[model samples]
Each structure stands twice: as C-alpha cells, then as structure tokens.
Target: MTHISTTNPATEETIATYDVMTSDVAFDKIEKCHEAFLEWRTKSHADRAPYLRKIAAALRDNADAFATLMTEETGKLLRDGQTEVKLCAQIFEYTAEHGPEILADEDRKHSGGEKRGMITYAPIGVIYSIQPWNFPVYQPVRVLASNLMAGNGVILKHASICTGSGLMLRDVCMKAGLPEGLFDVVIVDHDTSDAMIENKLVRGVTMTGSDGGGRHIGQVATKNLKKSVLELGSNDAYLVLEDADIELAVKTCVQGRLYNNSETCVSAKRFVVTEAVYDAFTSAFVEQMKAIRLGDPTAEDTQLGPLSSAEQFDTISEQVSKSVEGGAEVLCGGSAPDRTGYYYPATVLANCQPGTPAYDDEIFGPVAAIIKAKDDADAMRIANDSRYGLGGGIFSKDEDKALQLARDHFDTGMVRINSFGAADPNMPFGGVKDSGFGREHGGFGMKEFVNTKAIYLP
Candidate 1:
C-alpha cells in the first residue's frame, strides 16, 4: 500500500497516515493512465459531461466529510473549508455545461476554393499538476475540471500536507464513473517530483508554489520540452489614497489577507497608505483585525485560524522581526497566539521601509506590514519596487486616478481597485514576472490541456 500521513497543526498530533507509492508503483500507475487516456481522449465531449456531473454530485454528497478533513489538516475555518468544497463542485458543473462548446469545431477558408482549413481542439496526453495546500480541494478541482474536459489525463503531485484531501478527490472522481486511471494521485517527495517530470509520461506540467520552486520546476519542464504553467508567489499592495472610502477599503483588505489564514500567495502584504489618510486607516484596520476570532477551524463562528504548519508560523514571525529591526511599527498583533496551536495573531507593522524584507517579500501567514507613502508617486514606486508582479489594489475616490494607477504601474496579471484578491471561475487568473507563467480557471485554462491543431483540406 502507498499513502502519506496527516498532521493536525491545531493539536500537534498525527491524525492519520496513508501509503505513498514506490517508484515502481508510480511508474505502473503512469502506464495505466497512459492506457486509459487513449480511449478517454477519444470519447465525445458529450460523453465527458456526464462524468463531470457525477463528480459534482459526489462532491455535494460528501461535502461535510471533505470540509471536516480540510479543517482538521490545514486549520482553516470550517466555512472556508466548505467554500472550497462547494467551489470544487461548481467548477465541475461549469465545465460540464460550457466545456464542449469551447472545444467545438472551428470553420475557416483558405486559398479560396482550392484549399479549406479548420481548427480542431484535441487532448494532449498526460498533464502533471503540482498543486499547493492552501485551497486544497478547490485548487485541484480547477485543474481537474479543465484538464479532464480537454480529454487529458492528469498526474497530481499535490502538497504533502494535503495528501488526505487529494485522495478524497481521486475517490470522488472514480465514484463519478470516471475511468480508474484517468486521474492518479502520487504522494512523492521533491526528488520524485523531478523524476516524474523526467519520466517521459508527463506531457505538460502546471505548478502553484513559491517563486523559487516554480523557477526550478519550470527549468526542468522546459528542458524536457514539456509545456508548463506556474502560479507562483505574490506580495500584493493595497494603495489607499486620501480621498478613498476608509471603511470599505479597510474591510476588503483584511479579508484579502485573512481569507486563508494569510496562507494565500495572492494575499495583500504591503499596505501603501498615503500619509494624509494613514492614521485613520491604521486605526480602523487594527480595530477589524482585533475583532477577528481565531477559534478552532472546525467551528463555523471562527473567522481566522492557525497557519498550516510550524514552519509557516516561524517564517511569518521572522519577517515581522526583520521588519521591526529595519524600523517598523507593530500596529496590533505580531507574535503567535500564546497557546499550543500554530495560531499567529493578526500582526500589523507600520513604518515598514518599502522594498525591505517585510514589505516586498511574500509572507505566507497571518501578518501584515504597512508603509506610509508620501504621495501617489511614492505609492506607485513602492508598489512597483517589488520583485513580484502578481496582483495588487488601488483605492481612490477619483475613478480616473484609480484607473490611472492601475495602468501606469508594473503590477502584472490582475489588479482589483477597491476590492481584494479573488478569482472568479469566469475570469482569467494568473500572475506575471516572478509570480508565475500561465493562466488558470477561465477559458485560458482549457488551452493549457489541449492541442490547438489547425488543419488544411483541398
């Protein structure tokens, strides 16, 4: 038997352990997937729709179990966990309803009547997905929906911490009448990840992780000539102008950071508050950060929870200390909660030097650092100075100014004015520069898994 163990960050206990396949077993699984995909890819889009629908049904039926397991393993709020599960179903359903059309036959004419051309979408072979643990089920669900509908088999190298969640996903897909080998979950360490990439079984790979990890994996994928998409790290900045609505800005910004116990790569890290409104914004932001409840993740009333692991806590804490050393202010919370769990208080550091450790770096835990900007130019400079260009925000009463800030900036991918970092399935989601390479969860997602073949007939 091959499986991995689960750790409860809340209790410092090993809740369960499952087997992880050996190299031989993994290679065999690859063989099975390759065999299955040949027939699976030939199936009509109409045929694929039913399996997608069944997956949605299975997820809805087992939502409770999935949510509980998610909370137990990652220490996120129960509702947040449920949201992830629900989104999983929604993604599958959306694909079922709209995917076939996206892959429909393309009509074209070329060289007058002498020759005619058409564009047809066909499935790529195997897609290797290296996923993160933050969204657990939701993250994989997005990948699964797009790849499966595109008639591609997927080999998921999910995060070790979310091993249990990954198994549940595989089980649900199988129960939905999907072929056994269409999707296989592999629980291998980093070394095996490199091996899988080099195995010649993985045709394309998409990864979401730290910037450094993405670069390494991407290099390997490129070397192997495998198409790759990566959603790496982000240090989003929320620029609040003096004319902005203080109340709405503060509320939305907090949600962006604390949405996943601050584990999200897209969470806002730098609060570039203009000097004129810095005082008021800080006061209200601290008030909101204080009211957040850090109860057990299984509790529905809990708004905030612990980081997924001790290492996450340590990293965030170290960043805060570095910020203070470089002359920063602790607006509200800085240290971890005084108890047993991996709970860190909602830390706020002010007077953080732009481009310093705290302001520019991606903190994958529940801590925020604010920097006061002298003017709009300073705010733009601070926002652009980051090595990362994933997502960002600008809050201003003047619509023109807000739009201008977004346009005249180096912030790549997506930018939400007066809102937080959220990805609607209909919207294209990806980062630029050091953040990541390709898009996910939209029409663009399907392209990653399919071969866009153009045909000529005479």
Candidate 2:
C-alpha cells in the first residue's frame, strides 16, 4: 500500500489519508533524529524540564480539538478522549517535576570507602515506540515525556487507525518548542517498521500490543542486542471473594470491564466469584452490563461507544461465538446490535469452562466471563490460572484480607484492593509473565532507554 487512511469507527467513514513514506525517507528521518539527540543529550536534566512543562501546556491548550479528532478517528468517547489528553498532560507534568531528582547523579563510596564513585544517567540515541490505539494520546505521551526528559529523541510508529492523533501530538509538541526532527511520526507498514528496528541509529525499542506481537518485536530487538520494553496484553481477573461486598463488587467490576469500550489491556476481563456470592454478584453484574447505553461517541450520555474498527468488532464477535459454542452460556448480551457502525453490545457469559475463549483467552471487548469458585481460596486459584499476569482486583469488606490477597497471593503486576482504576503517573505500571516485562511510570520509564554510566574518581 502506498498510502494509509484513517476511518471513523463510529461512522464507518474515511476521515483522512496519509501518504506512506519509503524506507529511505524513514532512514533519513532517523538520521536527523539521531543528530537532534546529539544536541539534546548535552542538556542537563534540569535544563530539559521546561520543555516538558511547555508540552503539557500545549496538550491542555489543544485538548478540545485533539479529543474530538481522537473520537472521530478511534471511536473513543468524547469525555474519555478529553480525559486521555489531560492524563497525557499530567504525565508530562509528573515527569517534569520528578525527572531531575530521579535522574540526578549519585555519589557512592567504593574500594573500602577510599574511592568516590559517581553514577550518572545519560541519554542514549533515538528510541522507537510502537503504540496501540486504545489511549492514543496517553500511550505515546507516556513514552515521549520520560524519554525527552532523559534527553533522548523519539520516533513514533502509531497504529494506522489513529494516524491523525499521532500527527496531532507531534504537531502540538513542535508548536510547544520541541526541536524539529527530535520527535518524528513515521508513516510506514509493519515490514518497514521491522527493518527500521534493525537500524543502527535507534538505541532502543518499546511496544504495547499483544504477546505475539511483543515476541516478534523483542526477538528483532534482541537479535541486534537492543534493549526493548514490551507492555503486552492481559486477561485480568477480578475476584469476588466470599466476604466481598456484593454491591461494590458488581459496580466496580462493571465499570472496569466496560471502560474504554471494554478494549483496555488491563481492564477486568474475567470475574471469579466465590459460590457464596456468585449468584448475587452475577445477577447485578449482568443487569448493569446489559444496561450500558451504547451510542455515538460524541454524545454526552453514551456510556459505551463502538469498537475501534470493523476488524475489532468481528474479532470480539468471533471470540464470543466460540466461547459460547465451547460451553459458555450467555447471561445477558451475546451478539452485536443491528446498527450501521462497528458496535458490539456489552455481554456477560456464565458457565465459562477452561476450554473456552471466555475462560482461557483475553477477549478484548466488553464481554465479562463469570467463573464459579468453591471459596475464596478457589477464587484466588482461578485468578492465578491465567498465563497473563498484568493487572487484577480483589474485593472484600475486610480491607486487611483484601490487601494480603493482593500483596501475597495475586500473581499480577498490579492488584487493586476493593477498588478499580487505571494508570496513575505516580504509580509503577507494566506486568509480568505473558503480559510482558519492564516497568513504566513512577520514574522507571525514564531509565529504560538511558545509559547508566559509572564514573570512578581517583
């Protein structure tokens, strides 16, 4: 394909088209980005702080326009898109405020306290980031802010569906005084992307996608001995323990499953309920899932929007069908609505056995899998059965018990006790197992692509 086109998932209409760039052009841009990094690397961490502040300001200034574009391009709800912009701005602000202290040189005594050792975090070269479409603005911004603060150039290979959002982000940064070529958005296909990964100029690669995709990228980067961070998929399980608050569990599980049109990687996908409260929890959970108001993303009252594309809609539909055929029973919605856009109804599945997609795979849609457990111990066992361990939740009126389960028993990277929420800039993010490795946010991402040099003073 010579060009890439952006489509409105809600309207199924073409929003815009972008001409694809050749490998030669992408290489030239990479070279220029490296040159820019050469200059940026000379700046101290304190000197790099104001640029992030300026970028944060630019994001806020264009929040409305950028949010609308994201909604049109990816079927993100208008309110959600606006919130995403704000979160991206907040990430920049957090990095700006904390980066200097986080990356400052540390003096240590070595050789029996006779020699002084100085450790410095220095920027590497260009970092290539391949991001997904779920949180268009926030995904790229999280990477860009920390790396820029670390004085590294960045190249974004955003999902084709949200190309407009990618360009809009770059434009906002450039307008905020980011140097030209310091951050570039490449318009290319996956083949070109893979080749670009092997380029000598790019010092590191970070990607957010499925485990399969993560494996491919990690292999390519590792083959060339380049560092990579993979934030992959998750089939997060929210356990409704025997002592759980039925009402709170129902409400939070519903909110977690349905947020972001139920496409979030770490959002609640499996609901493991203890038999003592299984019936009560499923009854209210299914009712709420069925009550979700799916409509145009721009509307104020719409609780859910369409899937990001027809392909996504079909994939979710197939997963549901296969799960049902494999013995899962639909408690509420089980099919797509008879509508013009790529819309799938919020669905609830019970009698989910281990052989079915609802139980075994990560269904990236608004379909909740309700699994019955013998007790609280069995519920934790079921939750830990999954191969992916990204994020999860444990609900119980006994805060101490819930905290213990989250801390000692839960196998996920992040476990929310008696609550449900997404990314917070102050907290560490990323997961283990098939969900991928490495940490982001909370000052960890700034060091992912940096050179930690040890200076020995004689």
Instruction: Judging by TM-score against the true structure, name the best candidate.
Output: 2
Separately for all candidates shown, the number of backbone clashes (residues 3 or more apart, or on different chains) is 7, 0
lDDT of all predictions: 0.85, 0.93
| Cα lDDT of model 1 by residue, 134-172, tens digit | 988988888889889989999888888888899889998
In order of appearance, the predictions have TM-scores of 0.96, 0.99
Ten residues in a row with the worst lDDT in model 1?
A: 1-10
Q: Return the lDDT, model 2, position 242.
A: 89
lDDT of 1 at 229: 94
Q: What tens-digit string does per-residue lDDT give for candidate 2 at 1-458?
A: 99989999988999999999999999998999999999999999989999999999999999999999999988999999899899999999999999999999999889999999999999999999999999999999989999999999999999999999999999999999999999999999888999899999999999999999999999999999999999998999999988898998899999999998898998999999999999899899988888899999999999999999999988899999999998999988887879889998899999899988899889998899999999999999999999899999999999999999888989988999888888999998999999999889999999998999999998
- Residue 373's lDDT within candidate 2 is 95
Model 2 regions lying over 4 Å from their true place: none
How high is the lDDT of residue 88 in model 2? 92
